[model samples]
Target: MRIAMIMNGFPEISEKFLINQVSGLLEAGIDLDIYAAVRPSGSMRHFAAERYGMYDRTRYTRAARSTKTRVLDAPRLILSNFWSNPVAATRALSTKRYATAARNLKTLYFLEAFGKERYDIVHCHFGPNGLTGSFLKDSGIAKALIVTFHGSDINSYPSRHGTNVFRYLYERADLITANTSFTKGKLVANGCPEGKIAILPVGLRMEEYEFPKERVSRDEATLLTVGRLVEKKGHRYLMDALPSLRTRFSALRWRIIGDGPFMNVLRDHAKELGVSEIVSFEGTKNDQDVAAAYMSSTVFVLPSVTATDGDMEGQGLVIQEAQASRLPVVSTLHNGIPDGLLDGRSGILVPEKDSPALADAIGRLLSDKDLRETYGNAGRDFVAETYDIPLLTKRTVDLYESCITS
Candidate 1:
């Protein structure tokens, strides 16, 4: 079946799971095309973009442009594509959405670009894009529209835009997928029809992470956390836990991967807590570097908490990534996290924002090598059986078929 995958951007470093899904779907012999709302921002493109020849099959339109650029570009953008798809351009200009097009040239830009394609289904990766996908469907660009809500889309977005902001999108969409049960609960609580929601998690390529039998046995315990340095990641709480942890464990080293606005704050917090020497803020790492960090570490921790903006964790993808490496994971009992992590099996889960609980969980794992190994093995087995890429892709295929037939 021919499908159009709609996204905020293509080949984004942090959102490579979408790229992996595209690659997996293609390998499964599905015909696909990508339509991106925004031109990519960073230079660090995933290699799979080239490997899968996605560029040739993808179309992108800038999401927002300055008023000056819009005025200058909109005329040319409309006229240039007029001869190629005159009907679409003319029809787009006459539609009510054209009012939006007239105001925001990027709206017109997306309409003009996406108007060229015809697809059986339009699958939007995040809830915000459901409107664009529904517009495409309403304009007869696609037969059905499916939107997947990850994290902020269900959490922070509602707080900012107000709870019913998704009312139109939800009413227009044909299907909705939530990455975790907690997220699905939130969707229904916000008025989405419960029957339409399904739990389709972000998956991992299990075989790539050749489950380490044990964390490196060493003089110093190496703790690892891989996530953006943001409030939602609970880095501050981790720092809070460390000061007390230092009292019990003399040889402790913490490595943090990924960077964000909270870097300075976290660094300052670490310094203020007198744990700066033990903590290493290793900024964003490539795949190989992350895997190496996973292999070298004793335990993986995702101290996630609900952010101040109401943003919640969407079932920590890093949890499984760590588990795939057979590393024991310690995370908070935050929204969606419990769905991915098996408490006391994959790792331990503590109450949110409780530094003492987090420290105790980590300390328990650190002291017991056998417990770590047992949890690590169980975690890998769970990923292999449940969250493996190939396995999840088949489920996706079934969902696609159901959408097409119904």
Candidate 2:
């Protein structure tokens, strides 16, 4: 079967879900094509395409002449299209409310680009872009349309709109997949048909992230967190927990991997907390470097929270990657993290923004060797059983078949 995976951007360093899914489908002998509205910029452009075998299948279109131009013109277009072609702009206005006006201006850009591609199933990630795919399907461009709700799209965008674009997408999609039951529940609550949503956890390659044989035991216990250094990641809470935590475990070292808008703010907070010496911002690391960081650390902690602007952690993919490397994890019971971490079984889950609880969980893991090993082993087993790439790909293919045949 020919499958087209639609995304806002292809080969994005941040959204590895799209990359991993495409790679899995290709490895599974499925004829796959990746369609991105915009390609990567600068040095990242080349790596993004090559990393996912998207060099050939990927298609890029000129959305806007410049970022400034796109920003200024998007809303004007949305208001213009709101009256004439409401169906075309419904998904854009509803799914990406902030960018609805701007995206509405670029509706023709997407319509033309998607019109040129032919596929059996158009499987799109997130809601805004999925809305575009839905529009195409409705326009009779594809046989069937499938959309995957990846966290923020459902939790923040749709929930805030109260059955605007999201409800429309849910009602029109042939199938809807979510990364966690938490997200699926949100969709069901938003008036989406319960029978239509499926929970499909994102998968990672076990071979690529094998447990290191000679794991390092640090004299100063090291704690690691990997992700974009954004507000949703709850880096500030982690830093806040550190002052009290350092009083107990004096030699604790915190290593933050990944970079984002909040990096400077987090660094400043660490300095103000007087624990800057213990904190090391390693910035963003490649997959190999990330895996190595996981192998070297005592525990992986992601104090994720729902951001003020409604940004949230869909499912923490890093927890799975850390677990795959046989490392114990500590994260908050926020969004879809519990589904990925399995609470006490695979990793410890604490309430969001609770530094005391976060500190307590980290301290417990740091002190107990047997508990850490047990959790680490359980996590690895969990990933193998539920998140193996082959298993996930098969399930996705089955979903695609069901969508097309129905």
Candidate 3:
């Protein structure tokens, strides 16, 4: 089957799960193409994108243009692709339906890249992209449409645009996939049809990770957190716990991987809290760099919290990744995180924004070698059984077949 995937950006360090899905599909010999809105803006890169030759298969829209620029280029864009698919070219200009994007000729530019090709399925990663994929279905370019809602798209985006923002996509999409059950509930609350949605948590390439044979000593343990340095990630709360943690464990260290808009703020906060000497900002690292950090670290702590705008963690993919790497985790009980890890089994869960509780959980793991080893082993087993990429990929294909045949 021919498949086309739509996303907002390509090769993002934060969206490794999407790359894993694409790579798994290609490895299974599926004919797939990617259509992205923009290229990578961050310095960090993923190996799978290069290994799978993703760039060669992706088609990116041109950079954003001013109203004057788009008006000037509209005639050339229309004349260039008018003969190839005149119906699509004309349908793309219906301002009544397409709104501002149509008026600005953004749809025409996308049509120029989409060409006249047809696909069996067009899968979009987030809600807004599903609205874009709705255009493909409306223009008769795709046989079916599937949209997957992660976290922010269901909470933060809708919070800004209002809950009914996805009503148009709900009517047009053939199926909707939620990364977690919590996200599914949000979709239902926002008026998505109950029967149209499915829960499909992101999976990991388990074989890529190697569980450490030896545990780090309790006297000199390193705490690690891997994710975008954003407000919702609660990096500051982790820093808040560090000063108290230092009083207990002198040789303790915290290594924060990944970068974002909040990096400078986090660095400044660390200094202000007098934990700069114990904290190290590792910036944005690639997959290999991240895997190595997982191996060297003693505990993985993702202190996720509901941001001011009501955004929360969906699946906490890195929590599973840390478990897959055999590192014991201490994370918050926020949104879908509880569904991702086994509380008190593979990881420990604490309340959001409670620095004292965060410190206690990390201290418990660091002080006890036997408990750490047990949790680490259990975590590896849990992720391998529940989140293997090959198994999830087959299930994804099954969903596609159902959509195509129905």
Candidate 4:
């Protein structure tokens, strides 16, 4: 089936989960086309993007322009495409349904779909993009619309806008997929019908991560966290747990992978805690480097907490990656993190913002080698059984087919 995959940006380094899904869909022999709102700015990207020719498949729109500029350019945009598809060009100018977006020339990009054959299904990765996909369905650019709610879209966006912000999109979407049960509840809270939403977790490519037969034997207490340096990630809590952890272990170190606006804040926090030397803020790394970090680490810790804007974690995709690598995890009981890993079996869960509990969980795994090995082995098995990409991709395909038939 020919599908249109909608996204905010394409080939983002941090969003390896998206790349994994794209790769899986292509492997399943699906004709997929990517429609991105904007192109990614960085040079760094996943190798799979190149291997799978994702860039060639992607149709990128020009970045957002000023409202005045868009208004002035509206006539040209319409005249330029009217000859090719007059009906779609006319529909793109409708202010009744699209209002601001149409006036701002955003709808003109969706009109470009008429230049090619109509899509069978349009699958949007996040809620905001889903709204765009809903427009596509409404405009008859695609037969079906499927929107996947990851994290902030459900938790934080509605807080800024009202719960009814998604009411229109919800009614138009043929299917809605939530990455976790926690995320699914948030959708229902925002007025999405219970029968329409499906709980589909972000999956991992199991074969890529080599499950360790035994825990890494190391003298230094190496704690690894892989995620963007954001408030919700709670990297500060890891710094908070450092002082207490130092008293118990002589050689303790924490390596944080991925980068964001909060890097300097985390650096300052580490300095204030007098654990700057112990905390290493390694910037963004590609999939291969991330896999290497997971295999070499002693314990994985992700202390996720709700953000100031009510944003929380989704399924903790990285948590599954670490578990897949056979590394025991220690994370907070925030949002859908619990669904990503088995508490006390594959990993440990502490209350959000509890540094002592965070340290205790990390220390427990550090102190007991046998327990670490036990958790490590169980983690690999759990991820393989629950979050395998091939199986999940097949389920996604089934969902797409069902939407078309229904």
All candidates' TM-scores? 0.91, 0.89, 0.93, 0.93
Better of 1 and 4 by TM-score: 4
Model 3 lDDT per residue over 315-385, tens place: 98999999998889999989889889899999999999999999999999999989988998899999998
Error of 3 at 320 (Å): 0.9
Window of ten residues with lowest summed lDDT in model 1:
94-103
Cα displacement (angstroms), candidate 2, residue 297, comes to 0.6
Residue-level lDDT tens digits of model 1 in 1-406: 8898888777777776787688889889988888886666667666677788987778887545356876767668878657666665565554243333334543356667775678899898887677666567767889988999997888877777667767767887889999999999999999999999989998877766884346444334788999888889998888899977878888888999988999999888888888899999988777767877888888898999988778878878889988988889999999999888788898899999999998999999888888988998899899888788898899998999999999
Sorted on lDDT, best first, the list reads 3, 4, 1, 2
Error of 2 at 166 (Å): 1.7
Error of 4 at 137 (Å): 1.0
Per lDDT, the best of the predicted structures is 3
> What ranking of all candidate models by TM-score puts the best one first?
4, 3, 1, 2
Q: What TM-score does structure 2 among the candidates reach?
A: 0.89
RMSD of 4: 2.3
Task: List the global CA lDDT of all models.
Answer: 0.81, 0.78, 0.86, 0.84
RMSD of 3: 2.5
List candidate 1 segments past 4 Å from native: 64-107, 211-220
As a whole number from 0 to 100, the lDDT of residue 353 in candidate 4 is 96
Instruction: Compare candidates 1 and 3 on lDDT and give the better one.
Output: 3
lDDT of 1: 0.81
